[model samples]
Target chain A: MNGVNIGVLAVQGDVAENVLATQMALEDLGIIGTVNEVKTPEQISDIDGLIIPGGESTVIGTLSMVNGALKKIKEKIANGMPVFGICAGMILLSKKAKDRVVGEMDQPLLDFLDVKIERNAFGRQQDSFESEISLEKIGISKFPGVFIRAPSIIESGKNVEVLSKFNEKIVAVKQGNIVGTSFHPELTGDLSLHKYFVNLVKTKH
Target chain B: MIPLAGDLNDAKGIIKENIGSFGTKRGTSTLKRGFAHMLKNGVVMDVTTVEQAQIAEDAGSVAVMVLDKLPSDVRKAGGVARTASIRIIQEIMDSVTIPVMAKCRIGHVYEAMVLQETNVDMIDESEVLTPADETRHVWKWDFTTPFVNGARNLGEALRRIEEGAAMIRTKGEPGTGNVAEAVIHIKNVNNELRRIKSIYDDGDHQDLISIARDLKVSYTLVEQTASLGRLPVVNFAAGGISTPADAAYLMKLGCDGIFVGSGIFKSDDAKERAQAIVLATTFWEDPNKVKEAQKMIDERQSMLGLDTKNLELRMQERGSTA
Candidate 1:
């Protein structure tokens, strides 16, 4: 049995927590997968799946460009690699991102997911929040959603599958093999989302 | 999914009301502590203007410390350095999405209160600013906002933590752009922790009491520090860190993160240097990666460093002087 190999984009953000969650998810599924932090483009190419954890999207985008991993990941995604992005990660995957209060933002983004994003769609730091979100599409009924300086999906392409919503704004979506969540699922100690991503990777392999 | 209000004003109010009921787990301290924890392994840049804050944010700083002037400038000006103007602070807050932090003169609780009310994410009871109260420091436990204080050694770190500092940084002389003082201070704390850990291993309860007295903190906290082999809260490297190498060196020494002041924007290449420092700090364990980051900056464009010995105002000594 060949094990799945997963990579977490370690340019920045909550890398460690996601790594642990993925490991736990793999264990729960009784599947073999080696998790590693992908800093170089080579690492990104070698991974069976990749996750971009929540952090500062502006920094992550720039660093990914500097390290040359951005171009490589885009190629891998173009080839249909399964990628999961959380929070700022979700913002990066969007084709267009606008600030809810400020109108527009100019940060470097992967622009992979065909969706319009609203940065800080809820509120700023102190206004961060948590709520139960139904992601039944991924087989989870009520998953806790942790939103910190979170962004929500305002619009998506026809091919995109809407996964979850909070207060009526779209917060999670899946476009083909790309999955992005406005809220952090790993932070909530839920393994189903990560497991689902792993299963996506397995089926693709 | 509940549909949100169309109006931005209504959306904000609705989210606020929903979050208000849960009130977060534990209390104020826990919430603040959790925020500080998120800052671990990240760089917090000192910024003086809205432009600088934006640059810092664009450069990937986890947070920006709002200041009226850089510490080196504060020292050179020689007048009273107080909390940053509310107008500038608000402007910086509006400019950047990253956490905005500001420093208050030591023991100036009122200044802290103002910063907290302004909705800045964190406050620093910093000696970088002139001490407002010569005899005491602010009781941070009184504020809802988390406070980060400076320490030259383990005792000072423990004392400030006991005073309710949710975060701690080494009190190296600020504004020098010299990492020497910070290196020494961080080593002092690390070495002191190792010694205390040995004592703890030996079951020396009597020595713990005397150590607590010397640190001026509670015995239980001291014992906890010994048992954990580090400060109870996060400890960051601060004061006089200039180059990406300097940031990486401190990370290698086991500090959680870093705080860069005049070393950045004061230098010729603010954007490049800021980004390089963040990368180096993140990949400190890898010399090859650190070398790649080092190549990103020009040595000639780096900040002109001041000698720690030649400094007239020593911010690190403020803890004892008070």
Candidate 2:
């Protein structure tokens, strides 16, 4: 078995928690892996898989663009690297984001997930909430998911499988080796989702 | 003439001593100066892009909250974290003389440390949404620079102050887009303190301290609002504040100020809302003035999404260790 090395995008957002969660997930799964925070383009090359933690999407997109990691990440994903985008990370991976509250604020997306996202369809800060979701497609049932000013998947390509939804709003989806979630699975104490993503990495690598 | 010259020299020495004493009195002057600037002219704008941050500054907002894209993106992508990159923070700071603030996860001391080095004026230990550390609350005492922490009630506010926070804000429960809870919390705290003080005679420090200590409350709370007749120290209200009316409501509730995170920037009218909120803070008592201010806020409405509840829970779970 190849020892997996998972790197989290640490430019901004929940970098530390993702690292800890991933580390914990790997341990729970009995998988041999090293989790590290990836900031530079050079760091991206060393990881077998990458987790983009929840954070501000535009800032991450702009920083990735300026730091020259956006292209590198795209290239890596194109070359068959396993990547999981959570919340803002999912937004970055999508083909397009619509209904964005900021009005035509251009974001450089990864275009890996082949999906369209609606930013904050659930309302603003105080409207944030949590719900139990069933990812039956991925064998996940009754998973308590936290949605904080979360987005919803309005549309997805033929290749995309709707994984979960809350209040009929699409909150989780998976396309091939790429997994995207509107709600933060990492924030919840559930390691099953992380384990599921890690399985994708194992198969891909 | 010779004696007068010596006396003048002595007075100059005394003045220098007083200045030194003043510096010691304000142990965090470097931090307080930045906050004072925000209180005067800074407007907190909601933004999804570095470009939006720049635009907000240009449009008169002193600082901007970098969100994950924007609310519009939610229908297509889902709500995302809008954390600013170090480079972005650097750039924004470089662009404006006014201080820049960023949201960090509670107990994410490393992120706070990074922000401190970024030269930003204040770090909102905000559960504004998406925390980096899920295990601990970001105690303001842990950081070297001055920080503002959120409070949902008087107890929470007093705790933050006790933890050496330079400022406190009402946890404006993210994503609700309603200010009722914040207003309620503030009013309850204020009323409770007044009721407690009404029974005690003036100059009853011992009695007041004993009551607060017995109730497991902050001495600052009793001293400021209940005892010495002042509002709680460094109190601000955040979350669910959408209109000038909301801002005015908090001011009426005795909040020192308000932090309009998703409210002003999320509205269709950003500039007007920003200005209206400022006006509302200044003329909070006059309903007619507030009504006039409401017109201004109503004109500029935009939308953004925020989720600070999970972050708050995370902070609570972590407690005030970090």
Candidate 3:
């Protein structure tokens, strides 16, 4: 597989980690591809797939929306460009997001995935932790789920695929070309989820 | 998750430390460093009040650090500076939806414990406050709270990391509103990192050990820093930053992020300057965008910078060598 350009939204947050993980995933699968940090609409339009790394969703969503990158991402994902959102990214991709403590924060979102997300579902930064999880459908038996002030998918549409759960909470899900994980796979050394996304990007491209 | 109320002693290693580090590990290095990674490319602002915290959040700060006074004001009021009151911290935490951090005097364990008790997202073993212990910083690994510390060079940075700082920042001249010291500190760190990386690249294991001894840190940390060609944790520019260009310049120098201590509120136009600095920090690579950010504020609105050469309180030099 070649010429599959993957962009990690770089308005703010963990852009480098995702880029590094995508590069490693490509190397593992022996796929020739490029992973670029794209923030502007023009840069984002060139990518076949996108990965929104974990961060402060309010900051990322607000900044991305101000620069018009969020609108472009919404268009691309709607037209079948594969996208993977982690943590704050997952919150941005959902149809609706509310803060667990404050409830109903006013922030921008992609509105691509039909899910109701809870920002800081596990609680605050002090509550951030890691856990053993399995993405069974993606052929990974066990993975480290690094949750740092992470969000949770409280509800999902009928079409969404539940990929993993922790303590009976929805942590990972996939709907068509869009995938989201409340836990950060890039933070850990696991390349399974990233590789799976790469395979999807390669196939689609 | 068990709750420890009014019991500070049991809070140590509480919350089921074994949060899975691959397998059966407690609060693994990955979890600590991962916290820093999530904050990359973002601006964390210093706030003294609930109003300022709201301003910072509105300006897109990744986190707001609660302080007793602005660093500039702290320098002006030369008494023993300590952590902000728990009431104010909690108020700010309640007010903002973003992560809230607080500063404790360097090596002040009780202060850190109290801040952790308040449930601040992170504790700063900061030198901006008075150093509580002369020769020892707080042993951070004993507590579950992640920490960020200031460092003037690579040796200090590595030592803080060894002492369990999840994030590192330049110990620039606080309250001065000058980026010169921060520039010097980051350049020193980058130079040292380059030295070790070249040594590692040349396969000179013997030289790294000698350098580690000179730096007064461990060989393993030196090797790791060298191998990565960067710090094990996120390194943000801190202490003295005022202008949008100052932030963008540091970002161009390879800082993962920035902490504007007295930059925003110390100036005449707090709201506009805060937004401009955030914009400059996020789009640091693009000069045209930075130019637009710079034009957002007037020159008269900038904080009056102090001469670093004449300052009696060289905050960067305190609580370091340990």
Best by DockQ: 3
Candidate with the larger DockQ of 1 and 3: 3
Order of candidates by lDDT, top first?
A: 3, 1, 2
Q: Worst lDDT window (10 residues) for model 3 chain A?
A: A122-131
* TM-score of each model, paired residue for residue: 0.84, 0.48, 0.95
Q: What is the lDDT of residue A87 in candidate 3?
A: 90
Quality of model 3 by C-alpha lDDT: 0.87
Query: Tens digit of lDDT per residue, candidate 2, span A1-205?
Result: 6689899886545565578778888888888878898866898988889998775565566656755778888998998888999887999899988644444335678988888888766643323444556889999877866655567888889999999877677889988788998876665567888899888887777
Give fnat for candidates 1, 2 and onward, in order: 0.07, 0.00, 0.48
List clashing residue pairs in candidate 1: A167-B2, A168-B2, A168-B3
Predict model 1's lDDT versus the native. 0.81
Comparing 1 and 3 on TM-score, the stronger one: 3
- Ten residues in sequence with the least summed lDDT for candidate 2 chain B: B1-10
Which residue runs does candidate 2 get wrong by more than 4 Å? Answer: A1-205, B1-43, B62-83, B130-136, B199-225, B285-289, B297-322
**Chain B, model 1, TM-score against the native?**
0.92
When 2 and 3 are scored with DockQ, the better candidate is 3
Two-chain complex of model 2, DockQ on C-alpha atoms against the true structure: 0.01
